[model samples]
Target chain A: METDLFEQTILPHLDAAYNLARWLAGNEHDARDIVQEAALRAFKFFGGFRGGDARAWLLAIVRNTAFTKMRAQPAQDLGPDDLDKIEDTAPQPAQVLERAGNIEAMRAAIAKLPVEFREVIVFREMENFSYKEIAELVNAPIGTVMSRLARARAQLREIILADANLRETRS
Target chain B: MNCEEVRELVHAYADGELDVARSVDFERHIANCESCAAALRNVRALKPAIRGSYYAAPDDLRASVLRFPSSPDGVRQSGGLPAAERRAGSWLLTGLAIAAALILGFFVGDAFLRRSANQNLLAEITDAHVRSLAANHLADVASSDQHTVRPWFEGKIDFAPPVEDLATAGFPLVGGRLEYLRGRPVAALVYQRRKHFVNLFIWPGDHVTEIRDEKPQRGYNIVHWANDGMTYFAVSEISAPELRQFARDFTTALSH
Candidate 1:
């Protein structure tokens, strides 16, 4: 790949790369460093990247970098698998804040999701990558992508709205 | 499509990611099912909430990220000089470098009296102030250990800026370092005089010195004034009163 095209097309996605890295790293400094390293790798391996979902390809690199860092770290605080444990309780946004509500809880909810579900949500919801692009990026069958996305939305809905008594408490 | 099928694509439906037939079916479901309509609204609200968390890498990251590209600065590097223009361009660069040195000497002469220097001083200072805020390194010289902080600058900077134990006074000396601010290398004297960061940038420059003392950009209260043979810019997000106090200590550190 010529440097010019790489500069124009792929370079534009650095923020997307950083956003994914920030989530993966769970901090600002590491996220910044991770994206730079990922960019270099992506730039070097630009030839291997097929066109279409540049966002996903970048994300894949970020995921790899994040995992590499994760492996290198000493005992890590592994958050619970949110997707597996669907609370029977319903979601309420306002009340979540006052009673044991924090940003990490919301983040943990997103983070705990299954990777398949997480990827679809991050791409579609966070990065705004479309189904076709996500399909291309993750190298998934479009049906799998669609289903994962569906599951992701449903899961998010249940988790977000799970604090059923939030409105009552707020009122 | 059935209601179940229509519901499955509500996200796509909301995102306009659906095609003609699918969109029609999804809308029909939404029109009939009040639950689906409310679900759509709630889901839509999640987007903006999520967006609130989207933070950009510091503005200076743009320079570092896009630096090597044929950026505006890159254009300057790759000067369009035919053989005839080559000499003119070389002279321009040389003249600029010379002018920069003379200008820098006028302002930063006292602040930084050094041997030869490398880099674009103005851009680096600007870049440093910005990068510091982004990196949370606005103060390079941070320490409760006054002895450690003061002597630390011995090997690093040509001058020994005073390091005082200001923790009791609410200003603690953080560690100091040599960093590339704007584009030129400068002494990034860091001190946390309370919650705010004091980024004291010392480098040699005259042309951009005038821009010093310019009104603070954004929330950064900056005073760019040249002294001691170097241009110095002290910046912080702290209020004008606090920053000025920090600046006073910053300049007083130059006490020989």
Candidate 2:
């Protein structure tokens, strides 16, 4: 019966779980391990699921699992302070338009973003998750999710424009 | 609303997260303010472009997650008797109980060993299948023609991946992609069966052996075999019988 509940509820969201883990862990190998661990943890606690939006519930577990894994390792990417600084320097419209359609650059910029900012962008932009859902998943208020998303976009624009400028000068 | 208020809510408005009355007021304000309108346009344009850049989860990852044992205690319990029963029995009946326990332990140990090994491999291939679909990175060289797709893998991988157009058999060739499995690069052939996508991972086998096994993992039907110096794994969401037909058709085409 427990196995049936797990297969029916948690198994369906494997792709979403992996996607969240990949972004958070920043690589495939770590993402794979984290997701496996997260699934086990979810199964152990499946009885407590309370039955509302299993995808979000599974993702919350994945998010927590990934963070725990990240904390165990030393810091890797830009810290939260760097994200806050980038937030202040909003990119111009011309800059964003100039970098439009540059998929590789856009991807690189997103990858470089601090985890907090990167996650909100992915949840909102890539996953098409709503503000409310994201708030609940990330365990933050709606306002925090909104502002983080806005800052993430701002940071992405800044990085893309800077990279484009660097390429232009080299040639 | 003033520019400051409008700038703060621009993302919310563009995302349709705003209440209806606030959205109307927001639109009204943006209609007059040029910068606000431009901000809204930029935010809107960012959505699809970003959405297109999805990172596919690796297939092995999916398999591992799917096959994750429901509970650690469940595995332990399935392997043997409860702790109290074992201790009591050990004291009461030494002769017959020892013999029975030995027989049961041997079978249980053998089954557990074989299961863990098979589970590892199944997890890897299933993960590859799920990753391809999730990442939307199904094919590196996508073509229906055997001529174009077959030659594409010549120098890219160690072996020539057999690219066959199985359209006549109802399994239409979609394309082929490069995948890494079991520490070696293998060819993953994509085929369409109805709306489902079948990922057939092929690699050069060590010897000539005709082996076939089927397992259903996490609602996916996975058929694996080794034949004619090449190992094949056909994985999909299709039914077991249908997937078996696919595997048979694929092997026959390659052998001939």
Candidate 3:
């Protein structure tokens, strides 16, 4: 019966789990290991799988795993101290058309965004999950997800527009 | 609905996830309002751009994942092809397809040989890596947050992969990606060495498997070696030299 549930419910969310793991782990392999192990464990302890949202249940596991690894490591120095002045300058209409060609710059910009902003944006933007799904995945309420997404997008706009990391000379 | 209420649902709308009532209500409001309509258009535009930024993993990852058995070795395993599913037509069809592709891609000459219908495990591993990296669908759990991720491994594996904060080592731990390798789930610790990713696939290194040096697999530099009898692969888009350097550093960190 448990194996049946594992195949039916848990198996479907493997990709979702892997993506969330990759994002949390920052690469492919670790996330794979994290999710695989999480899935295996999630199955053995099927008692916890008393499902509201399987994706959320999986994500919560991923979040918990990432948090565990984070605690074991030494604290990282916070970036720039203040992320408020994140550059918000938009590209010139002409230049925008030119450099906006590739997705690389956009990825780099998003990578530079703070975690709070990045998580919401990545989940909302990349995963294509509903607001309700994301809220449940992050263990936050729907309103918080909406607000964070708004802030995240606004912050992303600021970062892209600001182009703080890039030099004006390049433009 | 007001602009704020309308804007919130715009994302929801772009996804086509709104219910019949709310969907109709929002559409009616958009019909009346120009600013809201323009905002919807702009928001919708962002979707493709955001998606485009993501690199989808190749089909093999999905194949391996689907082929993967979630049950324990105490149950079914993901190693090798299922006897029932291993038909000659699949391989023959694959071979014929590869041969057909070879003719069109004439420029790809001697450099890229025709892949045999029989999928090589090594090739599949590399394909899985590329496919995983290409897709935003890579990690089952995405976070730079290691805390929330590592514990999910407990009770599932007997060995720890020496997962730690390597930020001081210049590779800030990003998150983890789950991989099905060698019939078991191995944790791939994701870390950033500049822009490239190191996929440290760790499993208990027993006498069963032999380790090898970093090799260039399908253009991606792969550092496949064992430390503490554990297997790890640090793969990245960066040059082989840089990846090797990062791998050596990771090895040293693991040693201590």
Using Cα atoms, each model's DockQ against the true complex is 0.07, 0.21, 0.07
Each candidate's interface RMSD: 13.1, 10.3, 13.1
What's the ranking of the predictions by lDDT, best on top? 2, 3, 1
Each model's TM-score? 0.44, 0.54, 0.44
Model 3 per-residue lDDT tens digits across residues A13-78: 566666666656667766655665565446546676676766567667766766565453324443
Top candidate (DockQ): 2
TM-scores, chain A, per candidate: 0.62, 0.82, 0.69
Q: Write the per-residue lDDT of candidate 2 for residues A86-118, one digit (tens) a residue.
A: 223233556565454445556677888888888
Is 1 or 2 the stronger prediction by lDDT?
2
Tell me the tens digit of each residue's lDDT in model 1 across B1-256.
6655655566667665788877777778778877667656545544433432344456565455544221234324433223453354655564465445545454544223221112223343555667666545444345568687666444333355544555554677676655643222246667675566676766665443432343556556776666556676777777766766665655565563
Candidate numbers, best DockQ first, in rank order: 2, 1, 3
lDDT of model 3, residue B37: 84
Candidate 3, position A60, lDDT: 73
Shift in Å, residue B68, candidate 2: 3.1
lDDT of 2 by residue, B34-149 (tens): 87787776675555346544565676665545433422332333222335533433334432443354455555554554566567568878988997897566876678998988
Local accuracy of candidate 1 as per-residue lDDT tens digits, A46-158: 88977966657778877776667656432333343232332212333554322222333345556666655665666776665677877876677776676666556556555
Native contact fraction (fnat) of model 1: 0.11
Off by over 4 Å in 3: A1-9, A50-53, A72-101, A164-168, B1-9, B15-33, B53-256
